[model samples]
Target: MKNLILSTAALALTAGIAMADTVRMGTEGAYPPYNFINDAGEIDGFEREVGDELCKRANLECEWVKNDWDSIIPNLVSGNYDTIIAGMSITDERDEVIDFTQNYFPPAASAYVGASADVDVTTGVVAAQTATIQAGHVAESGATLVEFATPEETIAAVRNGEADAVFADKDFLVPIVEESAGELVFVGDDVPLGGGIGLGIRESDGELRGKFDEAITSMKADGSLNELIIKWFGEGVPTYNADGSVVTN
Candidate 1:
């Protein structure tokens, strides 16, 4: 079933691997190719590997618990889990609540609209080092903006005129646009909004944090991370290149 460990991932517990080190993990088993439950009910994705590596580096055991994305943080805060491996974006706002390891993956957020639309959205300030997609509709002059808590809600709101356009990740928006009843299109000329994702845990779990960072270093150094990105995102995601160079702008 593709269990994460071939052997206990080299336990890295501070005073030696903790005997009670069954680290509880939180994930939003919905984002496919990141951390989702397949039709066979097995949880798999890039973040899944991150969890596995962390356990090995920390010399701990893992117990992954799939939860709704919205509820993930609350559960962790309330002591329901030990770490969060969801493709959660690391922002100052989130940092206020939890600590993060160095980012294992950096994801780009984009807007999407219907396939029938002819809007050119790539006209925002261009950076010599980045690409960007746009939100399909322009905000009404001086119109108030409302941010949705989840990507799905944002897309639905745009379709209903409850909002003008949605800003979301490509992974979530692309599939939604294909089935949207309204014109589901994103702009192309907007500024690239990127804040990528990282591992999360309670602020007190410093032991786990060190382990996670170490594992990230190992995976990146060995090229496992780049291999996984290519396998999932079709070479679009910036992993690493054949010459050990960062394939990002």
Candidate 2:
């Protein structure tokens, strides 16, 4: 009877633990070094670190979900997960629908193109994150444009000579096209997409929102944040303030 009681108690404890676990979360499995799935089918990257830290701040459990870059928000709003831990930009447009935690890792904006060509300030630009802001600037200043997509696709385009350039997050590009040397140059960090990535929770989760903002700010100040950035982005890229202002190392 003693052995049977012990076994029953173990089962009950396990059930209780499951109930207390935090809600699910997700991100695109494409952005490398930032967030991607391992061979073991687990989500891992810089963003994973952010997610873990956010959960710790909120004192909530976490379970990572994986999906494409494009579908992250739509799925999130449909109740697929409690939040999107993806390296998603928080635009004024997006903010109208969902709430965002304070800026955690604000990657600088940089452009990439063929390893051989000069920076084409003439062709204007195209951005991976969308030109909703840059578009207005370019229209006012006058520039050129090409297609836009993931870095994988854009790099491939450059290789195939289909596109002239690719504007992207400076953190990832500094290393990805490193071999290209002159072929890939970081033209500028002037894009309108500022504020880096955010922890996207539902607008209604006010308590969770406050906790995440606190956690993110602390992580950045304590050096743990910079450690992860160096591990993936090397020592070149700068973490910016929310409005695209440069922050010193």
- Using lDDT as the measure, the top candidate is 2
- Measured with C-alpha atoms, the lDDT of residue 59 in candidate 1 is 80
lDDT of 2 by residue, 75-178 (tens): 66666777777666666666766778876666456444444545464563433333323333333544554534355776666556665555555555656667
What pairs collide in candidate 2? 115-183, 116-183, 123-144, 124-144
Return the top candidate by TM-score: 2
Q: What is the C-alpha lDDT profile of model 1 across 129-225, one tens digit per residue?
A: 0011122122222323454444455555656656544544566556566565556665553334435667876777777788877877777778887
Question: lDDT of candidate 1 vs native?
Answer: 0.58
Each candidate's TM vs. the true structure?
A: 0.70, 0.75
- lDDT values, one for every candidate: 0.58, 0.59
Runs in model 1 deviating more than 4 A are 1-19, 114-150, 153-164, 175-183, 241-246
**How many pairs of residues collide in model 1?**
20
Model 2 lowest lDDT segment of ten? 1-10
How far off is residue 15 in model 2, in Å?
A: 25
**How many angstroms is residue 82 displaced in model 1 relative to the true structure, after the best TM-score fit?**
1.1
